[model samples]
Target: MSFGAQVLGTLGGIVVATLGGTLVYGAIRLTVGLRLDQEDEYNGADLSIHKISATPERESLG
Candidate 1:
């Protein structure tokens, strides 16, 4: 396959895999009844799910 075709093919494969995985995951999440009552709405997934902040408070950084 040509270089362009190869890149396009790779991207196409990635897109398909990502979309399929997302659908499967969504269905599982729906069945399991896992909801994110995110206390750290401003903060993000790292702090919310992992219980560890990726970035320390600015004062702590100083």
Candidate 2:
């Protein structure tokens, strides 16, 4: 292959790899955020952190 062709091929490979990595990272971050939101909902983080309680009997430890 010519030198120009080799350089282009290398650049293309790099671009594709970078895009793939970005997509994977975004997916992982989204999944983690959703899971954290679910946990916060279940454990009542708002009550503990923000002093807002759905149940009046629950008190903020902070």
* Model 1 spans > 4 angstroms off: 33-62
TM-score of 1: 0.51
TM-score of 2: 0.51
Clashes of each: 0, 0
- Candidate 1 Cα RMSD (Å): 5.6
lDDT for predicted candidate 1 compared with the true structure: 0.82
Task: Give the TM-scores of the predictions, in the order they appear.
Answer: 0.51, 0.51
Q: How much RMSD separates candidate 2 from the native structure?
A: 9.1
Off by over 4 Å in 2: 33-62
Worst-scoring 10-residue span by lDDT in model 1: 33-42
> In terms of lDDT, which candidate is strongest?
1
